[model samples]
Target: MVTPRLRHPVRRIGDRDIDFSRRLAVMAIVNRTPDSFYDRGATFALEAAVASGRAAFEAGADVVDVGGVKFAPGPPVPVAEEIDRVVPVVRALAPFGPVSVDTFQPEVARAAIDAGAAVINDTTGVHDPRIADVVADSDATLVVAHSLAAPRTQLPLPHYDDVVAEVRDFLEHRVAVAREHGVPAERIIVDPGHDLNKNTRHSLELTRRLGEFADIGLPMLVALSNKDFIGEALGRDRDQRLHGSLAAAVFCATQGARMVRVHNVRETVDALRMVEAILGWREPAYLLHNMRSEGNE
Candidate 1:
């Protein structure tokens, strides 16, 4: 039998002393782009995007990741265009809760930070030195995601002597780069970049080996919601992958993932609560009260 993994704590956005443990945090995805892979044309207007963010929070999301461009196997937009698309959305959501800007451009990162974004979720893994400077200058948490190929390029057929080991090495180098840029270790989060350049087999292997990343001493955020791998595994289309996506979320929690970025907030949250219960973590007091016996003998 596989042994239960020991959990590690990770600091929240503004609270240095407080760490999120036991319960897995859910990050709702708010795609402002017209051509996002899954939620294409869902959030074209700034007001609509803000409303979506609010709704996601109501649905139990701990954070909202707002992105302007779709990195779905296509050429990247110009930096100026990307910044223009994302800045207003970031500014709108900043006051509501913690906002994370999903981009690999340094200028976009700088603009999003200036516009009140609290976190930088760069898919490039900080390969650009300027990105490091932007995060160092701004007091924002950084999510270093592992991606093998540029977003513009077609994902090269999955090539890896060993996918897990290569990912660990890439993540370690990224952590070192973040430290060299003067960013605190606590401010760093790592993502395995599911589907960024992976096939079904590689993605499953990464998920199975998720615990290995915990040794890096930072919180691991798994982004496996509605990904192609899930569809491939369940033999379903994008819209029908909800059940598979929830299964992946629960598995990630069991494997020690601290954060999950997903589209279906309510479903994922409900599934994770069940996983928490199975792990013997206490539920919220309100839930307990609801479970009380109405008529005791």
Candidate 2:
């Protein structure tokens, strides 16, 4: 039970074979939604979104998660419009490296895949099994994130008897659905859907017990960047939540989370690198502190 929780040593997302045994992946967010709670549509324009992806890749982001729809309640974006919003960014960024589309609609997932997205990041936990079928038909990865609300709908005062147990169980059920749809085991990832229809206490409990998710036997992706829970935890606004976010991210990574979805790509990459070094999974870039025969001090 104390062994590495991830069943697969390598998870092939997009064109990369992520070594889950040693590295923590950073899934950088580049939202194309004008009303995104994080960036406030900073990358809503096609060019801005593409530029953001490129910048994230340069900053050491392992995967670029391109989202066209805002997570909070919003006006409905027609399927075609959503496709129009994400497909181009997916196409532009796909060549650079692994590109994930944050969507739940089967049609949008199919379109994004056709446009070169390698991961269908369904934060809805694949409420519609057709999304699983779409992923199955392709060689793409699927992220089944646990969330109770329908896409763009609100779940007022969401409650759970035990958030961790319920979230883990939800993910297990969703993974089974994906498997039933022929999605290979190595291509499936799970996210606990922090702050998505969950209150801060629930999110914190999920974070505290995130290790329990290892029972699911798959790589875990924690999308806890700049979330309301972090803000509520430390009383910081979106832009000010970086420190709290890093703390949560590092804790989860140390506890065996394989991927962290975040807006602060470079910071996350740097922080996770330090964690990896401390965990013996990575080496220091330069060992200059005490290499000399005599101490400089």
Candidate 3:
């Protein structure tokens, strides 16, 4: 019943090796923006962002993603300001664990890499190949995600006849683009983009059919934490969608998603650990549940 892992797995990022073949990684999001959709400025301050990253890493997050600009629309954050917002946080977090900088700008990618970020989580799906070159120049990994339009430039009534197929095709194309720009296949990861440019129905459909994306042959990443799709599907607001969010994450994990980008680090980590143990990919932490010594019922 088990399927093959990513064709090219076990890439190195920083001083660590990411074996996406069997292990699922938890990437905790720590946005430096003041108006992010979730957490809304909770980690906006430089000190606050670093502290949040520290806590997330301590809580078992495999990677801490620092983003200076919000994925949603807002007044433009100049390149210099974006660098200022995320570079420090990356510099502070890199020494302790894997750090990913979420930006589509080549300059920001370059600076973050210089600051010790090991992954470039470009939400733009390599919309600009220049950023791909930035990642290729170093040994960093790249996250190529699908978004219909540039951040803050919404696509009014974005529609897709087959969300899964379209997203897969886009990822395939972007992965090729990355390779063309010198990024190796092993250094690449694909993300379906979830609700980035998709509506609730689209997001739900993509989630339902995400396992089909394994044909793309790269380790898949899903950022479904408290997304509007879960909210709209369950008729719950952002703060009330933890259960729904975890459900979607576990669903994707079962579909062979290699990484999950999330806001609730501890809860998400616990959920993924449970999933891994259930799938027999990991041993439970000293199982005693059914042992006679433990007095099973």
For model 1, the stretches where C-alpha displacement exceeds 4 angstroms are 1-10, 14-18, 284-297
- Candidate order (TM-score): 2, 3, 1
Question: TM-score of each candidate?
Answer: 0.91, 0.96, 0.96
Query: What are the RMSD figures for all models against the true structure?
Result: 2.7, 1.7, 1.9
Report how far off residue 123 is in candidate 1 (Å). 1.0
Please give the TM-score that candidate 1 achieves against the real structure: 0.91
lDDT per residue for candidate 3 within 1-297, as digits (tens), equals 224357787878777787777688999999999888999898999889999999999999999999998888767789999999999999899999999999999999999999999999999899889999999999899999999797668788998988888998899999999999999988998999988888989988988888788767788889999999999999998899999989988989888788999999999999999988887888989956566654545
Q: Model 1, poorest ten-residue lDDT window?
A: 1-10
Q: lDDT score of model 2?
A: 0.90
In candidate 3, what residue range of length 10 has the lowest lDDT sum? 287-296
lDDT of 2 by residue, 199-273 (tens): 999999999888787767888899999999999999998889999999999999877788999999999999999
> In model 2, what are the clashing residue pairs, if there are any?
none
Off by over 4 Å in 2: 1-4, 295-297
* Candidate 1 to native Cα RMSD, angstroms: 2.7
